[model samples]
Target: MFETIFTAANRALVAGLLAGVFLIVFANVVGRYGFGVSLAWIEEAARHMMILGAFCGAGLALREGRLVAITALPDHLPAGARIALRWIIVAVMFAFMAVLLWLGLKFVAFGWDKETMSTGISRGIPYMAIPLGCAIFLVHLALFARRFVVQEFEFHAEDTPSDRQV
Candidate 1:
């Protein structure tokens, strides 16, 4: 289940999206100046890819335990206390994911009829990334929760597997 979402394929998708953004933007710049012509759809594609990349990258970061932390409370807490803190963190993530998923779906529905300026793609296509990202986050959190219990409060950044390719 969660393994499906946290696969190397997703890592490749992120890499592809990032590459697409860079190439499109670069071509757009070259066309605008070097050739004095630019494709109208290029900007939209780049923007959408960037948005998707950002969301997917965020999920990857969350899954790998790479999100920035304050460490204010965790620094002072004991091992037992840290487990309680992590539980609280998971609860907060669940709540946040629920609301974001709901709003993202509504947003997708609302934009179903709307199309992009250049490609005429339904806005819902890109907007769908919202819920997709949340879904990824939910799966990640679930995996973390499982490990969180089995590891006996032993949640360390080093213990989380990363999908990054060096």
Candidate 2:
């Protein structure tokens, strides 16, 4: 349930970010050629949208296995070795996400007293995305690791002649 909600939010964030970019470009073009009235808020809004988009999309990327990996070595390894290496990579990723969650929360706590100049939104609101996204990414990573391990184990088991049927 939580994963579904977060995934939806991630998708929405990406769509919003793309829309913001399109609006900014369209506004600029219209202002330059048609109205001679440029929008000052478009750039600021676009910047904020970009940040939110990147953070929000990160969790979804982890869930979908879309992030880049150095697969050259893993690809050459034997089956068991490859599975072990993959597990190691997941462990490292989990550690990184933990650090990110801690630091991101600290950042938000420190900035909670501040407010944005134009929007008047609490600065902490935007900063909260860091920790929130990282936490979600951590959950997604753990689930992914569990699935990988389970699948590999099952595959190996099934490959055995005693476990197979002709």
Candidate No. with top TM-score: 1
TM, every model = 0.81, 0.72
- 40 Cα displacement, candidate 2 (Å): 2.6
Clashing pairs in 2: none
Candidate 2 regions exceeding 4 Å error are 1-6, 117-120, 147-166
lDDT of 2 by residue, 8-61 (tens): 776786888788888887878799789888766666666677777777677566
How do the residues 57-138 of candidate 1 rate in per-residue lDDT, one tens digit apiece? Answer: 7656765545665667876889789778878877888899879999999999999999988999999999988998788778
Highest lDDT against the true fold, candidate: 1
lDDT of 1 at 49: 90
